[model samples]
Target chain A: MAKHDKDATFVGDSRISAKRIPNIAPSYSEFPGKSEPFWPNFLLKEWMVAAVCLVGYLLLTVSHPSPLTDKANPNDTSFVPLPDWYFLFLYQMLKYPWASGDWVVFGTIIFPGVAFTALVLAPWLDAGKDRRPKKRPVATGIMLLSLIGIFYLTWAANDEHSRLHPSNGGHSAGGATAPAAPAEKADSSFKPDAVWTAQTSCQGCHGVNMEGVAGPNLQKVGSKLDANQIADIIKNGKGGMPPGMFQGSDDDLKKLAEYMASLK
Target chain B: MLQKMYDWVDERLNITPMWRDLADHEVPEHVNPAHHFSAFVYCFGGLTFFITVIQILSGMFLTMYYVPDIINAYESVKYLQNEVAFGVIVRGMHHWGASLVIVMMFLHTLRVFFTGAYKKPRELNWVVGMLIFFVMLGLGFTGYLLPWDNTAYFATKVGLEIANSVPVIGPYAKALLTGGDIVGAQTLSRFFAIHVFFLPGALLGLLGAHFVMIRAQGISGPL
Candidate 1:
């Protein structure tokens, strides 16, 4: 006969009795404690997570690359600044203009700031003691959407092959990478805004295909340096290279590096 | 095979709670029944944990090719993306996830704060949570310079100058982080140790304490 009033607060007071709960019988009296018991459920779950992560990391670390690369070279201009795969989608997203003018910056930087601010303000927004998802729709909605966004974006970044599927015979404004080879002329179809977004620094020095008009041919460049070395050189700027002196940031390097790595 | 595959799909889709009945959902009469202890805490802790795990993975991967010295630090990152297979992916994940972690941790803190989840008996827990936030920022600050590239180099220099602006302790603090007046091998190693070893260890401890306090205090009151 227990019911929640208008405030949705329960009617009973003092001493929580699990027996009254339909899920657990009233006959149940004991609650699990830390020292008096076997492994706690939370502890077991935590350990399970830890174990899986350990295995995944170990496999990744001990592989052919050995998870360690060469030292930082300040002189390598061809280096790229790619970040981890999880961030690639956002990195990819930033290449696109969201609104006008500063959309890329807003999408990449300010959007994340808003999300963090919302997260920090979560405790206050949800003051009710209700522990049910159904009870807190806004918080619940934001949480679910955020998790989906994170997982989807990270997963999407992993699928490079997905990018190659032909959309139109020519290029579409859909992708960041140079469209399939047939789209060489399709690139010209891009709006003036897109063209004006950010000039490829590589084009300034290394020619379109890195044909060595300004620097050296990058077609065979992949053979010269490993992935890590290339990233360092691109980021650190070596020899005569001006070190991404323009449009340089963490995300910029990763995107540009991925582009250079794809050159081969 | 079809049935098994369906079951597999079901298992992954079973993230939503299906078993809790009406009474099982209840707390004390004074407590708000709407607050989901599982969802709130789980969302915060789970996201934070996942991000940390990402950092560890990406960070570990970076270490595979990274030289902890001033001279090699920059080249190492380059080597990872250029030569190593899928190294770009790993580095991208690490870099992005670091920013995401900082963002999520702050969000988790905000949830705790607005909920008044930090008051009274939980004030000490609140302090621990604050400590976790500070350490996360510390993680970002130190990790940013690891690339040893021009951006990292100059940004860090600006950063240390900001540090040195802290009146008397600024110079020493700057010295401690940069290993002299400038960034070099000592600076890289110092940042690496603080990032991988020192700060992470402290954060893990604080996180544990934060969780313990939550369980002890139950969910905070409704507004």
Candidate 2:
């Protein structure tokens, strides 16, 4: 090993003085340093901290629960495309004026690529001798700016998301608005629209053409029950029918019920 | 008898000195645990590891009941949440653990950066840490689609579409990820494979490298 410089900082066992680098801050070697055995002391502290954190995590898991929604429906278009909260900043970045369509590369690539590269290269680029924030202007400035930018972008994205979907979380409630009722008189031989009534759902229990399988026969249902009674059953459900089975707007349900009433 | 057994193992394995060396390693006296951010640096790192373990265990539990098929994926998750005992809590832990790990990793990275710990011989460690960070994000993105809910389906569509916007190789990458131009059963399968296999494998490898470097270098001293 080369002879150590009395004035220089220790650069590992090779004794290569680190003070050779220019623009370096003065060494703190003048202040006497202290050291301790890593065994019992540090290990015990680390294990205690780990135990505490484990307990905290268990508590959190016990206290909080996950949210869930209905099954995946490909046909339903009301669902708004929202990424998880962690990615909301990037998601919002894509919504920028220059970030949409042709200029998307700038947002997704150029900007992020530059920032990431800068982060990876910061040690080399900002290797000032000082570790204090005040002494390292460029490093501190960059860190603060990036932090502020991320937070602002995240807030803006969340705000824009909330704004885009004023009523719901961008989810258009399937049956929120009532449909315009038909102006003409009730047709005695009315055959409910299969597509509108979602016949497959009804056929699951009602059998082919409402002849009844698990549910009562609806072939002459009109003679036994009024339209309002049938509508109640469809909405609230009865013995066999599950509530919310009729997946349609209010008008569709009312029309289907009326058509069933005319079956007799 | 216990001491004899320990001696026998130590004679062959030579574990005692190695452990003592690790225990006796000196950190700079200036490392003040009382400092707020300095403490958080360690706290968050520990939390990140804890959450990673929790995620792995909970995810394994979920897989016991979760059917990854298009028809049953959503239904299976519903059953797990509603029917299986402690399923909701386990799933919740996994869900929240993913988010917490990301947050902790981000904070740890920032702490290292601002503290100038990434300098000198530690640069390669920083690079490895970045690789692990990106892998963590990959884990999050892939795991998001496993539930196969409407939110998961559409978010994935948008995510893949963004991948499609990358100049030349974008479309191909998107196709590789989604298994087509759209998010469907194939996309779900791809995500499941990536989430459980690829990302975790890559993460463990990168993390091994990262910890090895950190251990060899010791914690960087306060500036």
Tens-digit lDDT string for candidate 2 (A148-250): 9888887787677556544224322211211122222334454445642465767645555565443555767788899999899888777535677777788
lDDT of each: 0.56, 0.72
What tens digits encode model 2's per-residue C-alpha lDDT throughout B79-102?
Answer: 888899998888878877887899
Backbone clash tally (model 2):
1
Candidate 2 TM-score over all chains jointly: 0.73
- Report the C-alpha displacement of residue B173, candidate 1, in angstroms: 0.6
What is the DockQ of the complex in model 2? Answer: 0.37
Q: What's model 1's lDDT at A22?
A: 24
lDDT of 1 by residue, A112-184 (tens): 6577666545555565665456667777788778877776665554443244333111112221223234312
Q: The CA-based lDDT of model 1 is what?
A: 0.56
Candidate 2 clash pair list: A39-B23
